[model samples]
Target: MRPWLRIKGVFVYLRAFFSFVLGGLAAGCATVGPDYAGPPATPLPAAFTRAGEPPEAPRVAAWWNQLGDPTLASLVERAFAANPSLAAAQARLLHVRDMSRTERANQMPRGGADLFYAHARLPSMSGGAEDGSQLPSRLDLYNVGFDATWEIDLFGGQRRAVEAAGASVQAAEANLADAQVSLAAEVAQLYVDLRGCQRREALNDDAIARQQRGLDLARRRREAGTASDLDLARLQGQLEATRADTGQLAAELDGYRNALAVLLGLPPGTLDDELAKPAPIPLPPTAVAVGDPTALLKNRPDIRAAERTLAARTAQIGQAQAARFPRLTLMGLIGIGGSHLSDLAHLDDFTALAAPRLRWNFLDFGRNAANVDKAEDMRNEAVSHYRAAVLAALRDAEDALARFRQRRVTVATLARAVEAARRAADLTRERERAGTTTMMDLLDAERTRISTEQRLASAETALTGDFVSLQKALGLGWAESPRH
Candidate 1:
């Protein structure tokens, strides 16, 4: 063909290719996917169910510290440093961060280099030299090349992928925050239980001592023919019951001690010596600064993590939808190759090539469509989960609030009951000393007072526990942990 004709043919082909690419570019921009809209607004209550006017209280950001216990604060810090669950969450956060970087790199140019050498010899049956008189000989060839590839985000597929990855990192970080919250709650609850058990154990000890005195008096009365055998047996039975109660309380104390050690990531029994001594149960503040429910969005890590997961899933739908469209990639390479290594020394021996590739999934039957549908379903599931999390958190807070209120009331009532019983017992003791009341009356009065005091101790501990639960429901204490 003539040169002019060949030139015309080249131009015609170039025009057709450009026309195809232009059409693809327009279609690529018309990406098919549903954009994410936030979940529907949920109506929140104006105030908590059991809101009350309490004495001015400290803020609950680090609610654990509000309890005013140095040992408990130190334990929270130790758990932050040593809890295995928190460490695992941190590791997951790092891994997700690196994965996000990997996804982002896909949208940018990626380059690599390779240097290679090969040695070869002709087969014995093949001739290596042109003269045919020379035998086969080995040859050395050197090659070096650098290549780069870049994927254009014409349809925003890679952009969606990167967005999804970033959301995943945020979700992972939220998971770490959630772990911190759970860890602190666990440690604090165990600490409260330990103290409560100690308190109950001491109560049991006092009850047993009081009964021992009653039994001694009954024995003297029986020896003097002033008390019946049935009365003496009754005293012994009561004393034995108190002793048994002490045994159970001691066992529970041990269980709490071991559980606390585990929360601190120490061997069981490691805290035996530290916790063996009895101490006052850490009490909650007289009042609570529980912010309104709107704060749940910011304060609750589980909710935040769930929201981020939904974001990631929504981005995945976009990525999957983009997969059904065309993708364009540009690849380029520069190389030096030679039968002899000396050829690499000359710039003239250098070679370069560039290519633009188009990949269209026009005939995958239904794979791309299926992926899009799957992603959409997954996104829908995430939405449901997010909503469920919100509802559940609200329910938890409301329920905790109600329980804390009732428990506090119960503690106060018992406090009054114990005081009244103590006063009555004191008057009865004086009456018995003045020979106005019988020995049996004095013993019964003393037993009632001691039992009432034990009940008060138990109720007070429960009130403290309920307060902790309320703080947990509000997601208030996790920020107290280091860098949650």
Candidate 2:
């Protein structure tokens, strides 16, 4: 046939082949297996059992700022930026997003350029001389070409794979958000504990000073032959005990600082100089805005991650089902080559090839059916996991709410006790000055006052810690922007 006629025939064949492929693609829109219809509905209460008159609006994203502590806010922001765990989660999100892109690209044609060189030697085909020695034939060929391949998604297998990949990317993003929420809460809790320790240390200092004064008074009375040796010994022991308590507080303060440093991605003790000075514990606002349980389901990162995972598993069912059908692949190559390397550049001396393939593992001893069944099982497992996540999130929110409410009551009661103790100490001091009570009575009153104050400080710190937990349970620390 003439070269021009051959080229025209090839064009006609390619056109018909592409038309058939397009028709097949149009018909392949019917995906196998069940289509995803979103997550199953989980029964949720309109409001949390422990949340009383919570606000309708969702909690703020940066809930740490509600504590009104600049230092804590700064620490939380630092953790978001530098915490190793959060950074790792962010990297995972990027990795999953790239994988999703790869899956989507699978549905499109792939083409690449190729350059190849070859050298070969073969023995003579005819009989050699009687001596059995002959020069071998030599051949060399060079080629430059462009090749393309496309796997037609005739049963939506690739489509389902891409869908699953996209869902997995979403799950990774939610995981990153969860990491951020956890990190922020940890930073705040440590900071509160550090300050609370400092407050207790200060109380110990005051107690130590008071005990020293009582000891001095006891010494004067003993010299005056009015106080017993036992009284002086007891005062000295109390002074040393107060001093020992300060030592414990110092160690605990160091621990809190170290933990906060680690949460901010710094070595332990890195925050020592910054947090050594005493400060009041960061206090939460009187009324925290905890949204309803429905909002909690939508806002919690773990719940979102679980739901996305379920979606990915559901898509996998279609991917496995589609594998039971045939797959069609089209491949084409166009190149110029000859025995001489120079011919590689000669456009007129060219070769062209087009091949179409169909593949089906129709007789695999039920392997494809088993794969489909396994995918369905995975999807069912994911459904259970998603439901479990929903319930766990609800439980966390309710438990945090209850703790926060009860902590507030405890703090108030301690505050009242502290006031009562202070009044009693004042009365006893006046009595001692009037000579109506001994120095021992005055020392006892001061000890009770200091102890009550210590209890109040500890309760206040716990209340703030509970507030941090509440914010964490509400999934309030992650930003609204897409993390990955």
Best by lDDT: 2
Q: Pick the candidate with the highest TM-score.
A: 2
User: What TM value does model 2 have?
Assistant: 0.93
lDDT of 1 at 174: 78
Residue-by-residue lDDT tens digits, candidate 2, 1-484: 6655655565566557766776867864667778889999998887788986456765657888788889988999988889998989988888999999999999888889898889998866544666766645888888987777888887789999999999999899888889888898888888999899999999999999889988998999999999999999999999998888877888898899989988889999899899888888889887778888878877899999999999999999999999999988888777768778889656656677778889988999999999999999999999999999998888999899999999999999999999999999999989999999988998999999999999999999999999999988888788753644
lDDT of 1 by residue, 236-318 (tens): 99889888887688789889888888888899899999889898989888778766777766688888888999989998998
Ten residues in sequence with the least summed lDDT for candidate 2: 3-12
Q: Estimate TM-scores for all models.
A: 0.89, 0.93
- Stretches of candidate 2 above 4 Å error? 1-20, 125-136, 481-484
